[model samples]
Target: MSYEIKKQRILELIAEMVEIDVNEVKEDSDFADLGIDSLMALELAVYLERDYNIFIKEHELMNLRKVEDLLSFLKTN
Candidate 1:
């Protein structure tokens, strides 16, 4: 998939995981700052796993501070 498309999908999944309107998710929005708790992060991991087939370890999630982190990870790995 194109990087932009992948990024968009990532944002969409994140929005869903957080139960927020997709329009509310900004590219630079920090995951924790989005009001996502630990349980929500795990939920996001599961959703992203199903959506992109990316096996995101818990530690890796910590490295993900913003939506760009996710896009970069998907693009490089």
Candidate 2:
């Protein structure tokens, strides 16, 4: 998939997990700052794994501070 499409899908998963609107998730938005608690983080990991086949490690999740981080990762690896 393209970068934009992957980014949008990531944001959509996050938004759906947090019950927020997709427009609310900016490229630089931090999940912790956006009120994503531990439970939500786990949900995101699972969703990404199932949807995109990206097996996210707990520490890797820490690196995913913003949507751009995810996009970069997806693009590179």
The numbered model that scores best in TM-score is: 2
lDDT by residue for model 1 (1-77), tens: 67788778778877877789999999888888888777877877887688678888989988788877877778876
Maximum-lDDT candidate: 1
lDDT of 1: 0.80
Candidate lDDT (C-alpha), each: 0.80, 0.79
TM-score of each: 0.76, 0.78
RMSD in Å for candidate 2, one decimal? Answer: 1.7
Lowest summed lDDT over 10 consecutive residues: which window, candidate 1? 68-77
Instruction: Tell me the tens digit of each residue's lDDT in model 2 across 9-55.
Output: 88888788778899998878877777888777778778778878888
